[model samples]
Target chain A: MKIGIIGGTGDIGKGLSLRISDKHEIILGSREAAKACEAADATVCTLRDRNCTGLCHGASNEEAVRDADIVVISLPFQHVAPTLAGINPTYLENKIVISPVNPMGKKDGYFFFDRPEEGSAALAIQKMLPASAKLVTAFNNIAAHKWTLLDEELDYTVAVCGDDAEAKKVVMQLVSEVSRLQAVDAGPLAVAGIVESITPLVLNIAKFNGLKDVGVHFG
Target chain B: MKIGIIGGTGDIGKGLSLRISDKHEIILGSREAAKACEAADATVCTLRDRNCTGLCHGASNEEAVRDADIVVISLPFQHVAPTLAGINPTYLENKIVISPVNPMGKKDGYFFFDRPEEGSAALAIQKMLPASAKLVTAFNNIAAHKWTLLDEELDYTVAVCGDDAEAKKVVMQLVSEVSRLQAVDAGPLAVAGIVESITPLVLNIAKFNGLKDVGVHFG
Candidate 1:
């Protein structure tokens, strides 16, 4: 599978590239194409040092979106609209889009869900994309810092929510391919707020409990 | 400790009566005193059949509240207002009150969080009680049906949230005493909405995935 990651120099993008590039082609996209290339090179070098082979390349966000089967918006929730606006809308049409963005804010040493006017980050992002684009919510609840720790296994439950059944299945398959990560179908797009809100909940849990990198599991 | 369940004929109340009555005195309270007594009797009989000793009794909601160190409001969200109104306000003063209530509804066969105007059920209930009453949220995300299945262990994470630090600690201790349940301090009472919303999310997950009684764990 060809996976394109917008804001590909970010922690989650770099982590995903290193973990999955061995089996899939990764296009790391950034506002500056040179920075994306640098990140892609770093990912390749890290994998090679471990005696592993990986395929990764870097490009502008628009170029990445134009050439991939799946496009992952790895940008923060607030940056999603402006970033997507700069890219041509035609590139995203009929392609599977993944949203790992979570809107949250910390106050008085505690985190709270800063929901957008559309109820959740996913719902708002859906409005920014073409109507044909298949938007799926996954990886939103995982601790952001944990994604870059390649030595650790991500054994957490990812709740996949989307309106399209086929697109959701594809995203669920991608989620399961990650290290020990189990994906469960968490109903349709309207349920995204619950999944997105869990990010801040886990953040607060980790903060109050003196724990690090907390994630969720469903049983 | 003397623990009183306000809606003692409910599933969660009966489950708690059966599970912890051996260690603490359980006063099961209901609007219909006879129903509470019948449920308390059933719990005692079940425990006796398993060669377990339990201490439990039944009374009116007001009488139960007047005589307990800890009070659990196990009623549904809609019933909470009327039930609490029927009880004397003085009975709840300066006591540790636990709200396991989750406000939710199903639409087109999918469950969504039906948040009240006060933001969450716990927050809404906090408004109805005296200023000295310590309101803590626990058991919000557990599957209600699973509570009565005595043979199965509830190996789930219970996120306890409250503003009162000491009262929150007491509730967390109580939660840990249950069957293999881990209690995590999930910040202040303001964060209760996130915890309560998980109930509907899990319900939708179970329904969409064709699974049974799904629950959450934070690790």
Candidate 2:
């Protein structure tokens, strides 16, 4: 399947591209096509180091999602609504949209975030996007560093949720293909609030202490 | 100095008592005196098993503070104000009172917490205590399991705050003597909100993922 990663110049966008580039055609997309080109070139260089081969191209966000079956929005939580609002709703119809954004605020060496009443970021995105777009929440709890280093078999669980069961199943299949990681079906999109809030906690643990490459595991 | 732990039957109380009993006159105090005695006896047995000569005794909260030079409150954040309110202000005056509590709320297999507008649980206690009473905030960010294990020499930092500089200095001294741990001067009582909020993050990391036994280590 052709996967389009919007905001592809970012750590998350590049990291996700690196993880799945071998099995799928990955396109790195950004507001500026030149920035996306730079990111894709950098990822290609890194992947070449491992003797892996696949296609990872860069283009404008609109151009990237035009021909893709699955679109991953790897932008920060604050950027999601505005970024999606700019895109034509007709083009987004019938495509699987994945959101991994989280809300976080820091002040005076302490950090906290305000969670939406609906309980998760994925649900929030589901509410914002066109009804034709299927929304799935995943990767909010995983560290960006660990996601980039796909070679390591870490004991981590990614909690995935969406209102559409089929959409979650497709994302889960994609997550399983990433590595030895398991994606848990946590329930509907409303549960995304809890999943989104968990990221702040992980970030706090690493910030205050010497914890590195942290990952969440669930039964 | 004769030191007392207000919530002496709980994990933090027993851990602190075990760490400090060797060098100080340690006593356990709680609302239920008999329960305090049982906890002290168990702590002694655990100390003996570890081949330590540390001794701990038990008493009522009222009697515990009546003569002690230092008193530590390890109750949950919700109970901190009332716990100190129940103590005699006259006894607390001119004596050091330490509090270490964090507020945490759980939902959907994930843990998150609400920040009290007053800031942290420690600041709340400081405000609730009599003005003449010396109140210090410490131990809100340390992992209870690492603290309970007396011989593990790991480099970890504890954020400490108080309105009184002298009282904070004394509490820092006690913290150093008890666990031989590094205590970072976080700031005045106002920053207690920031320090206390770190708990939910740590709890979320510990509860949600593969990062167990993870404690904060500030550089």
Candidate 3:
């Protein structure tokens, strides 16, 4: 399978790109061609460091997903809507689109988040994407650092939610490919708001306690 | 010093009870007599396991703070006002009242916290407690499991917020005794609302991943 990660140059994007590269042909997409190439090269270096046969390439967002079976949007929460608006939803035809964005606000000495009433950022994304696209909300809960550091034996879980069941299954498979990680079905897309909001909770714990990287592991 | 833990049988109460037992006279306060006693006994047992020496006793909420110099209120968000209302404000003179509470709600498939327009839960708690009482908000972000686990070095930073500078110093000393922790002054009591709301963020993260024990640490 060919997988394209739009905005694939971030900490999370790079982490997922590294893990998925071994099982599929991976591409790192960015608005800036130079950044896309840098991200792709960095991911390949990371894969080589892990002694894995993972492969990654660079392309523009459109070109990255052009021939891909799966396209993962890994941009910041604030950027999701406008980024999608710029893309031609028609090109996303029948392809699975996954979003893992959370809203967080920190002011003065307090840290909190504002959740969209439309539910989660994922649902908002799904609503905006073309009807032909299979939208799923996932990877919002997993810590990016955990992906890069922890080996395959540790039991980490990621919740995947989407209106379409078939699309969710693709995400579940992708989750399982990353060693001991499991994908839990947290219902449909409307619930994606809940999944996205959980990030701030994790962030708060990390922020208050001086923890650089923290992930939530369910009982 | 005589320390009062209102709602001491609850999760946060038990955690702090164990940590402070060695240096102070700890009193466990709960709505139920049996539960309060049970909580006191549990803390003693945990202390014994760690080979720490301290004294702990059980009492009703009102009786617990009657003669104590410091009072720690570990009640839930909704019960805070009513619980404190039952006590005599006269007994609160010159005492330090500490609060740690977070309010959360579930919408669709997501979990989020409800924030009052006035700001964080801590600010609300301070408003409810007597003005004569020194109010401080700390330990709201620390995970209960981490507080009790001796094998784990505390990896989180706790932010302390309050109006009384002297009271903040007292709470910081208590926080320091626990080891592997740092106390950061996040400003006055009015800003406490932000600090207290982080609990919902942490809870949401745990809920999404189905995690039992999750905590935050600041850099």
Q: Name the top lDDT candidate.
A: 1
Against the true two-chain complex, what DockQ does each candidate achieve? Answer: 0.91, 0.08, 0.09
- Across B99-202, the per-residue lDDT of candidate 1 in tens digits comes to 99999998988999998998899999999999999999999988998888999999999999999999999999999988888999999999899999999999
> What is the Å distance of residue A139 in model 1 from its true position?
0.7
Better of 1 and 3 by lDDT: 1
Query: Least lDDT summed over 10 consecutive residues: which range in candidate 3 chain A?
Result: A148-157
- What is candidate 2's TM-score for chain A? 0.93
Model 3 regions more than 4 Å off: A32-38, A41-53, A105-120, A131-173, A176-219, B9-20, B31-54, B90-96, B105-120, B130-219
> What local lDDT does model 2 show for residue B44?
90
Candidate 1 lands at a TM-score of 0.98
| Interface Cα root-mean-square deviation for all models | 0.6, 7.8, 6.6
lDDT of 3 at B68: 80
Q: Can you tell me which runs of candidate 1 are displaced by over 4 Å?
A: none
Report the C-alpha lDDT of model 2 over B1-219, residue by residue, as the tens digit.
Answer: 788888878877788778888888778888999999998898899889988877688988878888689888877777776777788788888888887877766676654555565655765676777788887878877777776776775355667777688988888888777655777666567556555655655565465445666555443
lDDT of each: 0.93, 0.74, 0.73
